[model samples]
Target: MFIAIFSIIIVLVVLGALFINLSPEFGGTISDSQKEQFSKSEHYKDGVFENLGGVTMSMGFGDYVKGLKGFFGPQINTRPKGAVPINALDALELANYKGPARMVWFGHSTFLYQSYGRNILIDPMLGPVPAPHPLLGGKRFSEELPIAIEQLPQIDFVVLSHDHYDHLDYGSILKLKDKVQMFFTPLGVGAHLVEWGVAEDRIKEMDWWGETSFEGFSIKCVPAQHFSGRGLSDRGKTLWSGWVIKNDGANVFFSGDSGYGGHFTEIGEKYGPFDFAMLECGQYNKLWHEIHMMPKETAQAGVDVKAKVIMPIHWGAFKLAMHPWTDPVIRVSDKAKELNLPIVTPKIGEFIYLAEPTSNGGVWWKNVD
Candidate 1:
């Protein structure tokens, strides 16, 4: 009876996994035509996408088991005791405001970037939760978003860095689809948007170093050191990347999610002296250190990319790692001060004016319990 019970339990677990994989939120697979195109790319190999500099996305069985054992280990201050203060957006003011480009961070990797008479939303995960299933992820750290999805102005373009749930939220996409004029993403990410009901014509799949222009802005999809997959299958089947936007002598770099690497220096050489840079700096651990940058590494990457001002992203939201909720900002600030890098620590929903060097965001998280 023990053997039979064990087999039944295993079957149930397998069925559960299969069900999750089949969910629409998991997204569609790459079609043969898509595969044919991907096969021609320098990054595609062995029927899978490859990271620059040969990164290992797989782990041995022994290492996997060890990781599982350590997965449920104690985390330190994963959530704040008090609410994270939020600054709501002024839609009217924002709509009327002109000059120097403006940005409002919506926490994590989401932000609204305005430049060249265009309003671009980057990784707009404005949903209450980041996970596909409500039970799967923790509640957002903030009490509420400053602005509702419907309240957002018509977005000129939506930029997705990759297909990860946190960065490519399904519900958020649905909300913005009608408002957005176009969608720009790294290759293979268009499948998710299509599955989520975004029109194919509105979606533009860009390869690494691919350039496109819209409304006088030169947008380029660049490399990032990360992997992508929404479900059990399709790992590394899509591309991940950062982006560079330049217009009217103002340049900006958006580091999606990347570890410390020569790519930063390479990007600097190609598009250095950016007016501003938004780099990921949270939800990182030693075990998965190859994909996500530690706080200090994030600061270094900002300098490497020749950014005049650096704003640490991918933090101050739901906790995805074991570190304290505020650890990322603290560490990055220390490193940025050490390097004398101009840093912006904006409160969630606060508008940041890019043209003014004195428009630095306050250390709002320091007062959060």
Candidate 2:
């Protein structure tokens, strides 16, 4: 019995060490900005322990352990090849894009926006998987990118809403770090990039309302009811947030990831009447309702933001929730129409032209297997 106990203790110690040393960077000192934001923020939740406070708000080790177990356990459609891949059509087009704004969906929360001669990428994940260990996570639809990242215009800024593997991908950042001019993230998240070989000067840490400006664009980090952490040890030591983007000709809101909250009304009234709002509309379940909004809430968010048009994201790829994959679209479409909200349900990789524009949308995912 004594020897068995000793071996168990030794195994745990070894695993813990590997988790730390094998990370992109090791031992990031908690930033003062992170401390101030989380130590007092209402969104912060002490999931694992009371003393550590706000360290595991969005993702707990326990939650991930459960997720990994499920991901590895199931095979949704053990299939044959030659699958004509959904969105296999020419879903991409670099329109003269001379209009005030153009938005493109890259599946899930990844989007590319061009407006007023500025190129911005939001939660851009052009990767195969959305997990630290692909061995433990599921795959995305359509293995190929509709259009390559390098094929696009030069990126001026990259904004991240959170550190969740789905929103902030390791492969995407590694490729984008040098190509893009700068990165803006909530506090403590800079530590992750710093660990991953990104320059500190290029990474800016923002508290809830921190703002930064480029030539013709201003980005403000707004409060998102979410949490952060790449590994087990450093969860809400960082902050997570959506963004309010103010440009010369258009105001755009990028919801990196959020659950429904009254903050939407506050954001709309404060800096809205936005030309377009891109909000989440999927990967939600009743079990995690507080962190992922239902489809109805998404349309409501559009109205609250005073947006002329709304695009539902955080779906159409990666079944983080088991709702037949098409449920979110159907539900959101119904809700948006019911609420008299203007919506665009584009296929993966389709560029949306927003010329004072609101698109009622096409049901592109209709026969998606």
Collision count for each candidate, in order? 0, 1
User: Which candidate has the highest TM-score of all?
Assistant: 1
Model 2 C-alpha lDDT per residue in residues 312-339, reported as the tens digit of each score: 8988767677556777778888999999
Model 1 Cα lDDT, one tens digit per residue, 31-108: 889989988889999878778878854567876676676558775688888888888887786666556687788899
Any runs in candidate 1 off by more than 4 Å, and if so which?
A: 1-11, 14-18, 57-66, 357-361
Best by lDDT: 1
Give the Cα-based TM-score of candidate 2 against the true structure: 0.82
What is the overall TM-score of model 1 with all chains considered together? Answer: 0.94
Clashing pairs in 1: none
Worst 10 residues of 2 by lDDT: 47-56
